[model samples]
Target chain A: MTRVVLVPGALALLPEYASQVDPVAELRAAALAAVRWLGPEAAVLGDTQGERVAAALMGAAGVRRGGTAAYLVVGNGSAKRSEKAPGHLDERSFGFDAALGDALVAGDLSGVDWSLADELWASVDGLRRASPLVSGSAAVDYADDPYGVQYWVMRWGS
Target chain B: MTLRLGRHEFDDDRTLMMAIVNRTPDSFYDKGATWAEDKAFDRVAQVVDEGAEMVDIGGIKAAPGEEIDEVEEKRRVVDFVARIRAAYPSLVISVDTWRASVGDAVCEAGADVLNDAWGGADPALVDVAAKHDVALICTHTGGAVPRTRPYRVEYDDVVRSAIDDTVAYAERALAAGVARESLVIDPAHDFGKNTFHSLEITRRLGEMVATGWPVLVSLSNKDFVGESLDLPVGERLTGTLAATAVCALAGARIYRVHEVVETRQVVDMVNTIVGRRLPARAIRGLQ
Candidate 1:
């Protein structure tokens, strides 16, 4: 079976950046559960900051990095969804995120408009690389933008 | 070392606020304000609400005043200790007295600590603390008599003298069967020392803390703060909190204070700044 899990590259998930009262507790819980489900050892696919978040989540779940059929990808949707978002309000953010979320759930990245994603501040490089191998419906664990930045925890297995 | 205050125990890193509740009609601060039993009880309630971990109930004023004998001292504090004990079961109750008889009575009435603010005037006070298995606050007053003002009391080396005297008193308490964890040493501020001496003690409080006995500092609007900033009792809170920050940095375990909320904030802030404590909920830019 080929398993793939996607989590947000949230800096808040890193132990060094942790606060006494966690701001992304629900997101962190969902991410950890999805990552742990990927198995004891797996390959991580992400950009520089995404790799750091992947390593931290791996460490927290006590999962080692090694060659495996399972894959963990760190990515998130637009950061300009609302006025309080990291990139501030953008009229195209909601539509861009809705398209991204649909693509992730359908296991297809052919419809992801790269230019619009860049304008919306979306992290989808690793998602695009792993899209060909993705198939079947995703078991969505989390999808929210509590801090104005869209995030989702979804898993695809074949 | 963990601190054991009678029925209550605290971890090593914990700092405690011991609020002063005066029952006398002529105490220096808040004179006669809590003289009535109900007013004193209200004061206790207020401090508790303000997050005081302990309350030091005093029957007699520290200064020389109309003579209050052992019988009168017990009359004022014993029943009050019992009442506070029944009211706040988890609050640590400390009695400020140098008399062995009063120590015994308050301990019997559920007092957890005997704050001998007069530097152990009654030698048998330690025995009473040991007999009741309560904590003892051993203080150094430069050998001054109880209730008497300091007159030309000069020390060859004030900090050294404070460490030696307080350590010796702490050892005596240990020898008298008081649990080592229940023994605390204090440099009695403004009790027998002049302003300069008190300031020096506050500056070099770490030496006393290094003695390996949990050090308690009673620096709440005392004469030393008044003299340092040329401010009177009502206006010395800032100076007092400044000195409190110095002591908190030096690792003082307990603070005997007048204003519970203010002193607690100062101590906690200082500890957090020095990396000894964490911010309550630090989420600033990390989120």
Candidate 2:
């Protein structure tokens, strides 16, 4: 059976980037839980910074890199969802994130527009690469944009 | 090292703000604002609301004045310490006195620390602190007599003298049965030293901190800052906070100040800059 877990590539999730008060506490909790469910070892796919966040979550879950049937993908939706977002406001961010989120939950990305995704400041490189491996309904553990940056934690099993 | 200030225990990384609550009518900064009991109580409430961890209640001003006897000093501060203790059980109450008799009375009334501003003028003050199991602030006054201003005081090396004298006083307090963690050293800026001497002490404060003993700096609106910046008492806050930041960078554990909120902010910011403290709730670019 193939298992897949998705978490946001939030730099705040890294131990070195921690603050006295956690800013992404809820997202971190959901991400950690979903990542832990991915089991002992999983191949990680993400950008450089996303890889750091994935490594931190794996370390926290006490999972080492080894052969496994699980795959962990670090990516996130639009960062320009609102005026306060890191990329500032983009009117096209909401629709882009909605379609992207739907495609991710449905484990289908053949219809996703990469150009629109880039215009909305979405981090979906890893998601695009891993979409071929995800072929079942995803259990969405979390979905929010508390800091004007959309984040999601989802898991798919087959 | 963990600090045991009477009934309270603070972790090694924790820095404390000891707010000044004067019971004297002639204190330089406030100038009789909290001289009355009710006013002093209100001051305590204000400082506690402002997030001060401790209060240093002084009966007599540092400057020489009409003689305030031990009985008078105890009358001014001991009962007030008891009253504050009853109201705020967790607030660390420190009595600023060099008199053993007043120290004993205030400790009996629930004072947690004896801040000997005169640098162990009363030889038995340490014994009183040890008996009550309270923390003692071992200060360096350059051997000047209590209540007397510095008059052309010169030292071979002011920093060395400060370190030597304060460490010796801390050792004496330890020998007198005071807990090692309960001892804090202060350079006593502007207490018995000229402006230049105080400035040197502030510059070389890391040497005192390097003694492996927790250092407390009482540099709030002192003459050293005023002379350094040519500002009077009310205008010396900026200079004082500047001095405070330097001391915080040097690893001072406690700040004795007239302005608790400002001093706390400066110390915390400096500590964060030095990587000794994490940002309060940072998510600026990491999000």
Reported per model, the fraction of native interface contacts reproduced equals 0.32, 0.81
For each candidate, the alpha-carbon lDDT, in order, equals 0.90, 0.92
TM-score of 2: 0.99
State the displacement of the C-alpha of residue A132, model 2, in Å, after optimal TM-score superposition.
Answer: 1.3
TM-score of chain B of each: 0.99, 0.99
TM-score per candidate, chains pooled: 0.93, 0.99
lDDT of 1 by residue, B6-58 (tens): 99999999999999999999998899899999999999999999999999999
lDDT by residue for model 2 (B1-287), tens: 79999999999999999999999999999999999999999999999999999999999998989899988999999999999999999999999999999999999999999999999999999999999999999999989898899998899999999999999999999999999999999999998899999999999999999999999999999999999898998999999999999999999999998898899999999999999999888887776
Off by over 4 Å in 2: none
| Residue-wise C-alpha lDDT for candidate 1, range A1-158, written one tens digit per residue | 78999998878888766655778889999999999998888788888889999999999998888876889998898888878778889988888889889988988777778787778888887787778767878999999998778899999995
Residue A100, model 2: lDDT of 85
Candidate of highest TM-score: 2
List candidate 1 segments past 4 Å from native: A81-91, A116-133
